[model samples]
Target: MTLKYALPVIALVASAAVSAEEYQAFVGLNADHYRASGDSETNWKLDGTYFFDKKVTLGPLDQFEYINKVTNVSASFRREFDTNITRIGGEYFAENGLVVSAAHTRASGDYVNEVGLGYLVSNNFIVRVNAVKPEDESTDFMFSASYNHQLQGNDYVGFTAYADDEFDYFGISSKYFASLGEGRFIAAGITLDDNDGSSDWSAEADYYFSKMTSVGLTYNKADSYSLNAKHFFSQNWAVEARFASNTDDSTLKTYSLGVTGQF
Candidate 1:
């Protein structure tokens, strides 16, 4: 499957709306262009999410979202090579702090399944275990944990850790979000991943000029980086653009554009 970087952009847009009321539904359309080794390809993706409860919000730079009891359904579709890659998933967050999620994905005529169980240990901490199975592979188990604490108002710091049984992979990351007052905010994060005996590092930073506009940059140890920006025309609609290039290979690049809607 093609690597999809859209989720980070989506999260950035959602975080920019920290002071605004949360939306009950979201839809996004994105186009990606890739050029590598003198070959180029383009693909399109459509994705959406619907919240079952109106009270659930990405509160305080999205750090306190675990406190909200909500259920949500999400799905996405991508077209490449005249074939479709599709996924559908749903999550239920119970009032008692239990969380359940399941998803199914189909790509290249093969299916993959995933299920997870989680618990909100507290308003600021959560843990989860997941199992995944591919059409021709054994099931793999993964574990993850996250903790976030509010510093002040909309400012917060968070840490996360993850491990998977299949690849002997382990990773840890940390992020800090600062609300600069007057609709401005800045956030940064660093991640370190270890698979078998190999290691990789990545970092990202973002700045929100206002509740409706933001820009971000991301870098990987593998000599690749991306810059992206997003702006909302109104409370319910937005547009985004991104450019990425690999430092080791000047000819390898990617360009993307996206449109998003909230209601």
Candidate 2:
């Protein structure tokens, strides 16, 4: 479905879900604008997730202690190089740690389809594999794994790695989150990607003023940087904004705004 139609459906579903005595769901909408070298593009996305069971948390850590069944759906529309693109996707997480996902994307009369399967190795680890096929193109397989470890109360570290068969591409990233007491925390991460004979890296750091407000900065080896901030108006509603620029090309920039609701 297109984002224009999907947004109202998301709002209606979220509204209906709020009336249920026991329901866990989240819905978000985002709009982004990009400009580079006197050219511009715009994108819109609507996404949501619904949980079938209550989320279980670990003691004092604010981390998930177990996996709960859930469904995720998203639709996006974008215009790039005067061509319009649309994508729709959904995923289902089974209670038994099995995950199944599928997506379809169309752009300039061309289409692609992807399917993936994932499993939770443990509460803190997961692995996934995906197959993607584009119209008139061969299918490609991709694999990914992630792990997270809690160091102490509300502090943790995580690692992720992924690669694809057809495109000799590989990437790995690690992040650390440190609690600073009183609902405040700082996080930093670095990612490295290798494709063909080239390598690139990016790093980001974020600070949280409280559980409900935060800001972050990200920089890449290519001299591009972005700043973002998020604030919650209440326990269940939030707004976010972001700006990105490229130092190598002063005219290249991006801006985005988003709103989210959770119950």
Report the Cα RMSD per candidate: 9.8, 11.3
Query: CA lDDT of 179 in candidate 1?
Result: 71
Q: Which stretches of candidate 2 lie over 4 Å from their true place?
A: 1-23, 37-39, 54-71, 79-83
Off by over 4 Å in 1: 1-19, 55-69
CA error at residue 33 for candidate 1, angstroms:
0.8
C-alpha positional error of residue 79 in candidate 2 after TM-score superposition, expressed in Å: 4.7
Q: What pairs collide in candidate 1? A: none
Using all chains and alpha carbons, the TM-scores for the candidates as numbered come to 0.86, 0.78
What lDDT score goes with residue 6 in model 1? 79
Q: Per-residue lDDT for 1-263 in model 1, tens only?
A: 32378777777667656555666788999999998888999999999988897643333222234234468999999997678999999999888999999999999889999999999888788899999999999999999999987786557788989999765899999988887876677889999999997999999998888767889999999989999998888777889999999888889999999999887
Candidate 2 per-residue lDDT, tens place, 43-65, comes to 77776665655543221112232
Candidate 1's TM-score reads 0.86
